[model samples]
Target: MKTNESEYDRLLHDIYETIDNPCAWKDFCSHLRESVGAASVHLFGFDRQRDLFSWSDGFGLANAEPLERIRPLYRDDVRLSWLRAFPAGKWLHCGVELDCADDDDAGGTTGFALYPVADGHRCVALCKLVDHQRLTVILACSAQADDAPLAPAARALLERLTPHLSRAVRLYARRFALNADALAARKRAPAMLVSAQGEVLHSNEPAQQLLRATSLVRVRNRRLALTAPHHARLLEDIAVSEARLRSRANGAQAAAARFRALRIVGEKGEAARDASPDGASSASGQHEVLYAFYNVVVTPDDASAAELRAYAALTFYHPRSAPPVDEKVLAAAFDLSPAECRIALLLAEGLALKEIAAQVGVQHDTVRKQLQSIFQKTATRRQPELLRLLLNLPGGSAGAAPDAG
Candidate 1:
């Protein structure tokens, strides 16, 4: 009795793990077959919509070809009838004799047990073969039974396992429903995922082409690069507007603020560029705001705007180039004296310091000192870094590298 108890405990633990990781049901089925010393074991899940029973796993059966053959008998015709008869939440166990008279070996008779899985309108069955006094379990999502009665021990185990098994099925169903809903939403509204930073993350075919020709080209670092800076500015304005809207208590104030921001973005494309010839700058353009109709509400206490903003930033900026250096970095690194910066344009043209001195009307030594200072300040010991820094300036590359002393 102690050994049987130990085995039962082990089986229950295995079952719990299997529920946690549904992918391991096959292994659980094999373990269950061995634990029960059964001739065959199978696990099946029912698809009510498709009206089919699929094999979750099976073990210790010759070829396992007959499992599918028996499924319809248990699931479709017989099981459905049984569920209709027993509408209440209850445990069911039954044994059945199979007619094998036509077979060459003629085993003559076989016995089986049936267990029902029911949650309101949903129902399924688990079946086990009971022959030669050994119990071989197979899970079936069916509602069928034969005339034979269950053994006392088998009845007790079914009673204990039913609640846990039903809960697992309900959890699985809920997850499946959620995934289906998400998929449907993605198909219906792909553009809602676009970041507040005016970078298009996903779009339909038409929107994709429109974005590509305008400011939506991807950066070298793989972020959606806004060629038109106003797009980014528009996003910033939207963020501010959203913040303001959140502060207003009344719907009228929120609506007015939303309209103001909408009109600003609608009249001027990001960067104040006029909308395309087709009036794409208008709110009626290819992109439309879905959130405008809804009132701004604060998230749950556990949620933070900072965390959400981080995710938004991730979508707009490439992970590698995030938090770009500010203009202070350029000012400090280039050691560019204001006057030298104004007059030393010739140095970037690859001119000799003497020629730059002549252009600036300064002594050659003075020009040389300015060039050295420029190199040191810009964090570039060499002229190439200076050249690169100049090239990357907001405007244009000032010129070529200056000659070394």
Candidate 2:
């Protein structure tokens, strides 16, 4: 419980190190509990809108207890009511929301008597809403531990730590995004993290934006999923094999694995399904959970103690579908209208007339008329001829196919 300049500086400085080494969370949680004399201290993440727990820590609690076992209690826990209504980074009572302290539900949320106590100790929580990473700090008293609220001294110490915690999360998130994007840039493919079960742990902005481009990939049940069975099977097999290898391989061994998820899709979402899976057609649009993504294993290195590491990183190795087309350049080169330029690019990408129409949200006849106009402007009366001309134009490599420059 000692507070000093050295102690404060020490934790503040290690925030980046913790992000690089998640196991640091264990140490921090243990330190916080020791400082506050709580029965148990937990840092919980939430989607307050749904009152769901995104993540929870195993500190001063039953390590073997699964989230489902505690979910019922957490849902009814009164902290949620306030969490849903509280503004960003606001320290709240963890008790009630909108004067609804008196409202009772099954999840043990009693006014002033927050339900999820540790052996009859009051559980206190404070929340900081940092965009999608809403985090809450929960403190519970043990029958033998401190039953009173956090002492002013303890509160003051925490007041110093909270802002640092939020900044760390944001920094961690940004770093993750940059890393994922770098992978995508290098492989020329969208990159994401999936659990051994293929549940998507994370994806970059490009990956999310690609979701609508094709049904081959999707995020469902908070997991990265696939609608195309062929790709799913391939991903599962690769993920499983890689997971096993990574779990056993050392850093050098993993680096030599030469592992990649091949031909998942061209252009992230721009290409047609490369192969169909057996049994179910993608046309049904049914999503199946992809099991096999994470390749976690304990490894030791001289640089530090034993730590968790991903044995394998997943990536798509394929030719990009197309580069973004510069509509203005194409139009200027071909002396075509903006609408004509868009249709020409889609046509060159090998999309059928119907597909192009669907992508552009236009009627079949509308696409036909546009095609005719484009042909007259460019002196090409057939689809193939127009596609060839469009492909040859500058800035015709790839794009969303701007309807206008």
Candidate 3:
């Protein structure tokens, strides 16, 4: 009795400490398995709004059959009546056994019947709201039955663990909100955490606003879909190009070279930083708007056997509210020299020929010569036409980044 009591106490402490760190689902699930003596453990969450389901820390399920195959029957298990009506801090136990029964009249096996006691892979569970209080949690485990009732010990441990689990989720939400708020302070950009198939698991306010106002791209079933077929094709090509660039020999070295050559997609501002194999791909406004695609991996709690997990975190930057563009973008996009890029920006700012020369610290004739070169390179015949074109360039606002010349 003494040893059992002490072991249970220690397990409770470990579960608490484990979830205190960021992204602690795996560690918490491990501690849960050892504490309950269960064969498997799973943490699930249901988003009522999107009606989406996600699970993590599924122990002993790595080699198990894919959930999708079983999903038709068990995806939304009617047997989880208690789960649908779950309490905040209380642990729910569900176990039932289907056994062959003899037909009373025929004296032969008639049908299978569930035994009174709860029996299943998923034996214990907990739930809470996470991700800015928008997502719900259902943490559960599958512990095999012993002759003696283990419920008391399980309850004791969970009582100690539930509060911490809820707190950890709240902490993650807070961290996400803080990061997004910080970015919004500087720019009117927003981000999303999307599944590989494009399901949006989480989205910041800025992203929501951008989507509501924009028609070129829309969120359907919580996934990003492009309105223009051509735009979608272009984006697909960019993703393919970047992915191929990342797969070559000396891929790391080659990626840097290609990034410099393409002058597109990097963590300049609010880039997808999920750190998965799908890495973040982003595009800010050229003259329209910018979007970021972050790849996320969705590993189940019992990831011992399951596969196929990637997500696309979508981000949006409206051209009307975009941050200033760097000069490098101008030089690359318009194929202008450094001097020409600076002069182009100055011309957009309503500076006269002499004024631009003065600001650029060049002689009048030198500035005039540069202007002609800029005119030819930019395909504009005169200053006013050139100004209109430059002013309409992406991130052409007063708040744009310093002249990238």
State every prediction's TM-score relative to the real structure. 0.29, 0.35, 0.34
Top candidate, metric TM-score: 2
Candidate 1, residue 379: Cα displacement in angstroms equals 58
* Overall local distance difference test of candidate 3: 0.50
Winner by lDDT: 2
Off by over 4 Å in 2: 47-52, 63-79, 93-113, 118-121, 129-146, 174-405
CA lDDT of each prediction against the hidden true structure: 0.40, 0.52, 0.50
User: How many angstroms is residue 310 displaced in model 2 relative to the true structure, after the best TM-score fit?
Assistant: 39
**Native RMSD of candidate 2 (Å):** 19.4
Q: Which regions in candidate 1 have their CA more than 4 angstroms from the true location?
A: 1-3, 61-67, 74-80, 83-151, 174-405
Worst 10 residues of 3 by lDDT: 108-117
Rank the models by lDDT, top first.
Answer: 2, 3, 1
Ranking by TM-score: 2, 3, 1
Candidate 1 clashes: the total is 13
For model 2, state the Cα shift of residue 26 in Å.
0.9
